[model samples]
Target: MLGDDGAGPLLAEKMLANPLEHWHVIDGGSTPENVVHQIRQLKPSLLLIVDATEMGLMPGDIRFVDPDLIAELFLMNTHNMPLNFLIEQLRDDISEILFLGIQPDIVGFYYPMTDAVKKAVEQIYQALNLHYIQKAFEPLAICEQ
Candidate 1:
């Protein structure tokens, strides 16, 4: 995890421990731009950017973050560049993008995450695992063999 700024990485750590066969998990750290190149190289059909974001919601709340709907003033994540710009660059190749965000209660310089945030992390882990497992086995062909 990223101390105060790494809730997404914490979720990623928990998710990658078991590792779903059909998915690849990468921790983008505080600056996603550094890793955007790697993601662009893969050119995956789906991209999910999970982060601890400031979306004017309650602390420890979870909400779907929409790039198009997000205003520029809310660009308070630790990254130097805007994430929407990155997404727009990959727009042509990437099929879908989902930004899952968890609101943080406190972001002090420390190792321990707050209890509310931890609960949010678990909720995200349990919920997303089921969805990914179902996604892994979906029909990929037009006609049966």
Candidate 2:
């Protein structure tokens, strides 16, 4: 497995262990495109996508990225399709779409996540947990390393 490239799945596993009250977290893996049909079935009002992205920032830095700007940010090309295209497919069903991007330190095969990126995953999990607890529908603030 590629280092911090596994961040999204890692976060999905953590969320699954605790399980959110209203949120449905799916570990789409390397083929997120495969989940589009399932996501459409759920028809959630808000869709949050988490992934390790290359944003020219520090390894652990996290940002709330616009889907339209993902290409410019140079997201990791591990998915079956471009992320923006995926977002476009779900746009009609999902009222709000949020992309939570974590900057990866290493993307090589079999490399484990760096300390900073691991910490970022924890921070994101906690933030999402708190966000749902408060029943907030607004976008999250940028989470720094």
Best by lDDT: 2
Per-residue accuracy of model 2 over 1-145 as CA lDDT, tens digit each:
8999999999999998998667798889988988999999998998999888777777888777777777754566578788988898999899998888888899999998899889988888887877742232223233421
Task: Predict model 1's lDDT versus the native.
Answer: 0.69
> Per-residue CA lDDT of candidate 1, range 1-145, in tens?
4454678888789878977555678888766767777888888988878777765556677766666644544545766677787778767878888777677766667657887778878877766767752232222121211
Task: Estimate TM-scores for all models.
Answer: 0.79, 0.87
Worst 10 residues of 2 by lDDT: 136-145
**Total clashing pairs in model 2:** 0
Question: How much is the lDDT of residue 131 in candidate 2?
Answer: 77
C-alpha RMSD between model 1 and the true structure:
8.8
In angstroms, give how far residue 41 of model 2 lies from its true place: 1.0
Residue 134 miss distance in model 2 (angstroms): 12
How many clashing residue pairs, candidate 1?
0
